[model samples]
Target: MSEFGQVLRGAFGPARVFEQRPLAPLTTFRVGGPADYLLETRSSDEIVDALELAGRHGVPVTLLGGGSNVLVSDAGVRGLVIRPRGGAIFELDEQHVRADAAVTINGLVRWTVLHGLGGLERWAGTPGTVGGATFGNAHFTGQLIGELVTGVHLVTRQGHECDVPVADMHFGYDRSRLQDTGEILLWATFRVERGDSDALRSTARASLAYRKRTQPLDLPSAGCVFRNPEPGRDVVPDGIPWSAGALIDRAGLKGTASGGARVSTVHGNFIVNEGGATAADIRALIDRCRSEVRRQFGVELREEIVCLGDAPVISRS
Candidate 1:
């Protein structure tokens, strides 16, 4: 074994750290290359340990949750990739619920509804973990997950555990301060109110149904490709919807294909891997969609799904 491998074993134990780990299977898109080193951490302590070790070695750290919102490069990711496996949920007090970052958004929704909570029912079919949701300010029709967050516990880049109030999160459309701070989300606390279980479940079911009808859920793809452009800044033709999907559809790019990746006919914003797609194929499709959208409408669409590894972002200009 190499000296570096011995060091990894020292920190995480024998065979716990996977070297040259293929990252494709871990993502919703099913298309990344590999991680130089991958560790599945069962608790926040392990995650912090990984961070500290990587920091000491000057290696980069990437936190992957349910892997729903990122596109990894075909060239793969460098340094350490940490996947948190913690999934604990607890009631902090009346009207407050605490969930570990690894808790699936759907699981959290179900638990909340089953426990007679109302606020999270609309996220019933959301993919990815609570940490991913909070990191990206995951949104549905009229709600962003950040709106309900009371606080979040995170490990900062300096290896300090701190609680950040909602006010410090700087939540906005598809954004949170975590993106800039290099903080690893440990857990988040949300505020909820009592509601009828049956009613909450009904709402959850309705959301699931809506997603089924409108999204191409049968295939592998990162959720939404782009953030909807602001209506005030980018005016669409009258009668045309101002949403990102509608804009892509109006640009006549639906069902477009690049290798194994194709723009979803069900939703113009989703680029699904029909089968055997590569990160390059998916990225080519994204570029095509963005270029065409710009040609048809004077709006520049921003991506909601983040690119991981060393993938080069297509110039928005």
Candidate 2:
């Protein structure tokens, strides 16, 4: 073990510090090499301790949630990868609920419906944990998760634990201040309202059905690859509509393949792995879509997916 490994084991115990852990099984993309150190944390205190230990050892840290909306490099990640576990939800009141960061969005949605809470039903079929959703300000059916967040508990990279109000979150279209600050989300409190159970279930079912029909759910994917171009900031492609999927479809790149990665035929914004896709393959397809969209229509597509480690180079041919 190295100096950092020794310190980590000394502080957090040897059982918590794992070396050269495979990362593919931890992600939805099912691609990537391995993490040099993997720390499984069950609570906010453990997360803070892990971060403090890494800081003392001068070792870097990566926070992974439900493993959605990310593209891990084939070269793998160096340093420690902290995965928060032991999801627990606390009912603050009849109209408020607090949950750990590891709680899945789908699980939260289901829980809300079961309790007749009406705020997160729109994200019924969304994948990933509350931490990932809050990091990216996840949205579905015109509803962003950040809007319902009342408070966020996080540990800063500097090892300080603080509670951030929702207003300070700086939520925006597919973005939040957390993205820039590199803070590790621990838990969150959401404000909800009492609603009819049957009505909420109906809405949830409809949302799930819509995703099943429009999204390529049967295949492995990291969800939407690009954010829709903001209105008034960019010129809308003629006859292409003002959506990312529409623009990519109009560019005639749907189903385009690079190695094992291919543009999802059901949704142009998603790149699916057919069987044995590499990070390079996915990057190539993303580059093609961006280039073609920029060339044909004067709009620069922006990626929404987070790429970790060294980025793969895409070949132009």
Candidate 3:
């Protein structure tokens, strides 16, 4: 054990902290090596304290949100993994909702629609958490979380907490300043719009039905593997429409496999762990698909899935 790990164990206590914890169960991919140390924080204060301890001792810290869009390496992660508590909701203004970083995106969407909020209706069936959504600036059906984001509570590297306005934060397609900066998200507020309660419910149901029909929501896969590239820029001003999925599927990339990871037969863009999939397996499959797609269509695909750990390297280039 390193000096930082020892100090972390002492400061946070061994009971709540896990040593050499497997990260597979914590992620949607169900594949990854163990994290050196895993800290499950229940409150914002704990999150600040644990991260501060890691920083003081020169230990790296990786915040695990819903773990939906990430691919952890087979060799696992070094340093510490911080996972905060989930499913806490706070009511704000009449048309606003605040939620802890750990609440799943599906849960938030359901709550928003139940309360007559229409803006989040289209996102009702999306997987993952609000923090991941915000960090990735997630969007679907012509809406980005950036549009509804009003503010975020940030815990910086120095363990200082501040309320940040979304406007002051830079957001591009599926990216935000929070991702580059060493800041952990505690909570966020969305400026939702009020609508007829029954109508909102219907909209949510319709959206959910649409997702069931289109996406491979039931599979064990990160939502979309790639952010649509620049060529489909006309679909949404800030995002790529006529996505890589459409292109890949059109190129007959669906159900393609390199190893254990296979492009979902149900949805070409989703690379799934049918069973016993490894990080290397998924990377190989992703690269093969990207390469083949680029060869056939002359369009390159950008991965939306975030890779962690020392997983095998596969380049489409």
Candidate 4:
């Protein structure tokens, strides 16, 4: 460990920090090597301070939420991993809901239902945190996070805190400008409408059931692998009306394996980490499917899962 690590240890202590801790246990996929330094923050203020310290010390930092939609390298991350825990800050108001960046999307959906709010129920089973969902512009029922978000509070890489109106956020299909701009989301306020509690619960339950039935929710995997491209009004064979998953499925890539990673048998778009899978295996499978899809259908699939760090490459063919 370096002298900077020693100083961080003195400031944060052993309980909140770890040296060379395995990230596999922290993520849903159960794949990845250790992070050089790990910091589990309990509040946004703590996050801001940690970011500032790491920035000043010239150490790279990666923010981890639920760790649902990422694939980390086997060689491990070179710098610090900051994990934030959201609690009562995700509470609801009369016509709006506030969620800390670390709050799970599923938990937020449940909160909306409990508070008699509508709009987020369609995303009942999403596997990431509110910040990840917003960063990715996640959508269900033709509704994206941008539509519900009223405001976002974030700390920039330079350690300045600011509130951004949702209207100012540039949101596209499965992509957010905030990601390119490098803003660390702290929390968000979402505007919602009143609805019957029982009705909201029923809607959420139905959406959850549908997702569980279609997606391989029992396994360790990121939600989706590719963004659905736009299609012309004509629903022809060359049109992009169908999703990338359907395209991969039609290409006969479902249940295909490269090392320990497999295109999910239930859903072709989800690449699963079978027991003892490595990051290289996932990357290989992603490449294989992308290659085959392009060769067979002429449609290029764009990755939705965020890849972090560099590792040894694996060959699928």
What are the lDDT figures for the candidates, one per model?
A: 0.88, 0.88, 0.81, 0.82
Model 2 spans with C-alpha error above 4 angstroms? 1-3, 6-16, 311-317
Q: What is the TM-score of each candidate against the true structure?
A: 0.95, 0.95, 0.89, 0.93
The stretch of ten residues in a row with the least summed lDDT in candidate 3 is: 232-241
lDDT score for residue 80 of model 2:
91
RMSD of 2: 1.7
Regarding lDDT, does 2 or 4 come out ahead?
A: 2
Off by over 4 Å in 4: 90-93, 232-236, 239-241
lDDT accuracy of residue 191 in candidate 3: 80
Model 1 alpha-carbon drift over 4 Å, by segment: 311-317
How many steric clashes does model 4 contain? 0
Error of 2 at 178 (Å): 0.6
| Model 1 Cα lDDT, one tens digit per residue, 1-317 | 65655677898897568888999999999988889888888777888888888888888889899999999988789888888875798988879999999899999998999899878898999999988999999999968899999999999977999999999999998889998887889999999899999999999999999999989999999989899887566666677787899989999999999888999999999999999988888888888888888888867888999889975534322
| lDDT (tens digit, per residue) of candidate 2 on 1-317 | 77777777777789877788878788888877788888888788888888988887778999998888988888788899999886888889987899899899999988989988998887889999999999999999788889899999988999988999999999999999899999988999999899988999999999999999999998889999999999878888567778899999999999999988899999999999998888788888998999999998989999999987654544533
In candidate 3, position 130 carries an lDDT of 78
RMSD of each: 2.3, 1.7, 3.5, 2.3
